[model samples]
Target: MLVSKYFKLNRSQATLDFLDIHIDKDIPVFVDPTSLRSLKTEWGHHCVSLLQNYFSCVLSAIRKGDDERAKTLLSCLNERNEFHLGYSKKKSRGHALGPASADEIWKSLSKSKAATTGLLTDLEDAVLFVDGVGPDMLSDAVCNIIRGPLIEYTQNACLYYEIPMEKEVSSGPVWNAHLERWEQSLIELPLARGAPIILIPKVVVRAKQSYNSNEYYRHYLMPVLQKHHKDTNSSLVHVLKGKKNKGEKRVYKTDLYELYGADKLASAKLTVAHPSALTNYRDAKKSTQAPPLDHTALAKLENIPNPDFPALLNEATKLRPGSKDAYLYEDAIEKFISGFLYPSLSFPVKQDGIHDGRKRIDITYVNSAKSGFFEWLSRHYAASHIFVECKNYGKEVGNPEVDQLAGRFSPSRGQVGILIARSVADKNLLLQRCKDTAADGRGFIIFLDDIDLRELIGQRYDVISGDSNHLLYKRFKALIS
Candidate 1:
């Protein structure tokens, strides 16, 4: 069963910030390090830093000929089955890189031309030159290195959804960027069928890694070989008969492939000779965008449907204000935002305490917007975090509620918030009060009533088809204007 279904969270994969992984089997996805470097969010940058530090340590150990330390470092990268990712055929029995394999990899790196020439920078680069190290192994190693951040993300997701977790679970080997080594911690984690599972963010996971040996061989290596064959007039070139022209020549790409098979060592040798090819490849990968998986793609992967916003909204509206079930409204809003504004906002935390744990925001999300209004907010208002306050009040929301959300904002945490209320007796009154908060230099607060939320939900289909009129953009403009 999927994690959401198992926990009865009443959520679909589309509405979740983290992947709703199967409890017993593995999913065919990977955490691409190149994708991590492509992210614009603070969280992404932090993860990239961790990756850099860990790999730097490995490189240093190999360079200094510290065989014992290098072996110890690589040994920490056991298959991380808890993530329920990779190509595990049936049940997720983790495939460990045993002592012998570790030694093999260590020796390969030690004697590697790519490593000696500074071409192997990140773990993903190992796929290009190192024998037997494929995307799955590199991804597993990355998972071990950044396990700390993943653990924190999982814990926060659990807290947001009220998922049950076991206390004092071993955190596995997490990379310590400061100490330049791996460390384990005892912390709370959600367990499935008596085994602990780590939640991976949907934004970070990919159907295939951006960095691939095949891609390097084809796009980078083959092109260089093509130029070489053309310059040398090698046998791989073909002279073709044209309709008008007397002579025309072309190269049989397939013949070139047959001549030089897709071998990593051969490609590495070519790269070493024409180092610019490697530089160009790195630049191209850096420039290419690695967009987060959309709702449809995520749904298809998990074999689930995208969220039914209208039905979800109806369920939330049915709950009575000030009742025991009133919290469901907050949960519903979180689901709605996560479903719609993903890749813009992610990793939502519930009851996020600030001011030394004295004040609690209802929901907080990392402002990970690559485009649209949230991106604008990040550029202009310093919205590193998106604060939300859910008020399930039966009547109109006034100054106090607006003040509460605005109070949660700061230059550091972000200066924008959204106040979600059941209904507003006077929409203009709430808007004016929110304006007053902005005018006072406290923060920007946008008020959304149930009716307005319903309007947003009603536009779901249009938005999904890429015909969005940018409703949130209009709402923010209305607030500031």
Candidate 2:
């Protein structure tokens, strides 16, 4: 069972901000540290700092010849099956660093030329130069180092979804950057089948590791060899076989690899001589942005079909307003909105609390909009966070609804929101009320009734071409005009 299904959240992978991982088997995605470093969010910055601190500590231990400390640091990375990710063939038994593997890892790093010469600057660098360290191990090591932040994210998500968590579970090996050591704490954690569960943000994961030996060998190393052989007129250069380019000849790295057996140490030696290639590779990886898994990819991993949009809309529209199951309608609306405005808005916090729990916003999405209306709102209205209020009322949404959403806004939280309701008896009056709020410097609110929502839902494909926000733009225009 997937985490969403197990928790009865009634949400699919399409609408979730995190990967809805299965409890029994591992999903074939890995957390890419490069992606985290490339993020512009506060959470992304924090995760990067944690990873750098922990990895730096390990390097310091190795450089100082403190074998015990280095080994001890490595030993913290046990099999963390809670995440339920990676390439496990069956159950989620992680192949992370255990005691034996930790010793081997320490030995490899302690004797490595890359480690001594400062070539191995980050965890991703290990995949290029270190033996027995691949994408899976690198990802596991990162998860261990940044486990604290992941735990906090999981807790916040659980609170939003009303998923129950066990109190005082062990938080394993959180890196205390200030103190330069590891620490453990007892905290609340969700459990499944007698094991702990930690949620990973979708933004920080990729289908493949950003820095891999295969890509380095092909793109970086081969190009360097090609330049070197061309400069010296080395034996590796060969003439073209086809008549299209009769006299053309080029240095082929494949022939060189055949000669040197495609060894990492040989490639590392070449990198040491011509370091610009490695620098170029790192620079490229740093700039490239890897998108999170889409709805179709998420469904494939869960062995399910794509989200039925028409069915989702039908379910939301059919629910009786103000009934005992009104919450279901709220969930349905959230699903539609989340799926509808994704990539533009993400990390939706359902029923987000404010003013120390005095009030709650129905759904709050982090403004990750790179282009289009949400991005425009961010620039003009300071909408770093987009607040949403879901009203399942059968009557017209009035001042109270607008006022409620406005109350949740502030200088830090943002001043823009979307009000989703079943119906509005007078949308122009509601828009006038919203306009009044905007005029008073309180906030800006846009109302989306079922009809408007249907329109938005129909234009969901426009999100890709940056056109899906036209409906929202129209509604927002009425508020200001």
Candidate 3:
């Protein structure tokens, strides 16, 4: 529904069909009717249902490029909001209120009270904080914060990414140097108010810097900038940034950016940029200066159709276009059971997904902390292993499925039928049967997509590795030797 309204597409047909397969719908989508707080896990991530809204918001901003407005919209968003977006200054009746002037707006959105406050009395009186970062040729992922939201300004003064909220902040010599160099770097830029992104191949990240600094750079700074490129997801990048200030010895570590092509970092096609540092360099009064506006792409993003929640749910069951249906959803249950709860049961997902696999599996990885596969046989099959069954349908596997697994296994190798289903409603009786049978044996209905699978395992292909033995390590380590 929100997607259709913002992107100006027909709501019913506007599916998030990114990949080729029609069954790829398991990639999380945002469901608006629900809120984030209700579904937040112990880890505080938004529920899986809200992922679609998150994508909608980000996509809306990028495609529409209402630079100033987008900055305001994105800053105020958080996991608490279920990542549900559609925030625009136009809808805020209080946006024009006078009691709170622009002076207070910037401070409110500062490192502590991070959120986009729509009212800015004097956008011209802003100072864009930055470091002397060039293209990614230097920092790699180390100083990714510096390589921010896609920019148009080049003479090195690119249109910097907006500081959403100060999820975290650090201050010190090592950190203070980067910030100082950044502030100092800002003294030379043309824009003053917004956090205009500047690039330094190596921003000189300081590990010994305050934890506040590390958290800020990692969560807010990196995530904000990285959201620009989809490939940046899952990069557990470690910094190899600039040397310390004069007193500290210059560490000579190779930055990861050197490995990237400059062509990839180029994206002037989107937003605007301005690189002229404060020409009146020595004046502290200059942080109030503003750059001329590039009035070229100021048109508000056109509205598109957002999907209706009822239809989306119905479609996932029908196994239509982009429908994960039930197969992928069920496998996610196995991953969560095996990886998080039951280490013994945890294993990588099968790319081809699961059927009632009559034979052996294609891929299997063993955890090192546990014993080997052969050891399972020695333990007399008492190991907490269960046979997995992933069903991509609306109906439950019922007592029949449970009995089928029970029939196959001997007492030494006890078996449980982990039947995964899409909607829990249809599986009601079957699930009860599994529970009742638990006393005699262990078999249960996982009812997969009843909850968001992506919120459990992931949205992409994740593989598990079993080569944990010391001998295996020595053999692999020998290659380096």
Quality of model 3 by C-alpha lDDT: 0.27
- Expressed as tens digits, the lDDT of each residue in 333-408 for candidate 1 is 7877777667778888888888899999988988776666676777888699889888888887887788789888
Greater-lDDT candidate between 1 and 3: 1
C-alpha RMSD by candidate, in order: 3.0, 3.1, 23.9
Q: Write the per-residue lDDT of candidate 3 for residues 1-481, one digit (tens) a residue.
A: 2322222332222221111011111111111111112212221132222233332342344345434544443332211111111222232111111222322322323321111221111111111121211111111211111112101111121211111222122211011211211121222222112222222211111112111222323333333334333344334333445575433222111222232212211111011121111222213223422211111111112222332333444333345222354444443333333322222332222422234665432222222112333233224333333444555655445666556544544343333334445545554465456556554644322333535443333321111223334322232223223
lDDT for model 1 comes to 0.80
Task: Evaluate model 2: give its TM-score.
Answer: 0.88
Candidate 1 lDDT for residue 281: 81
Task: List pairs with backbone clashes in candidate 1.
Answer: none
Candidate 3 Cα RMSD (Å):
23.9
Error of 1 at 428 (Å): 2.7
Give the 10-residue window scoring lowest on summed lDDT in candidate 2.
Answer: 461-470
**Candidate 3, residue 416: lDDT:** 30
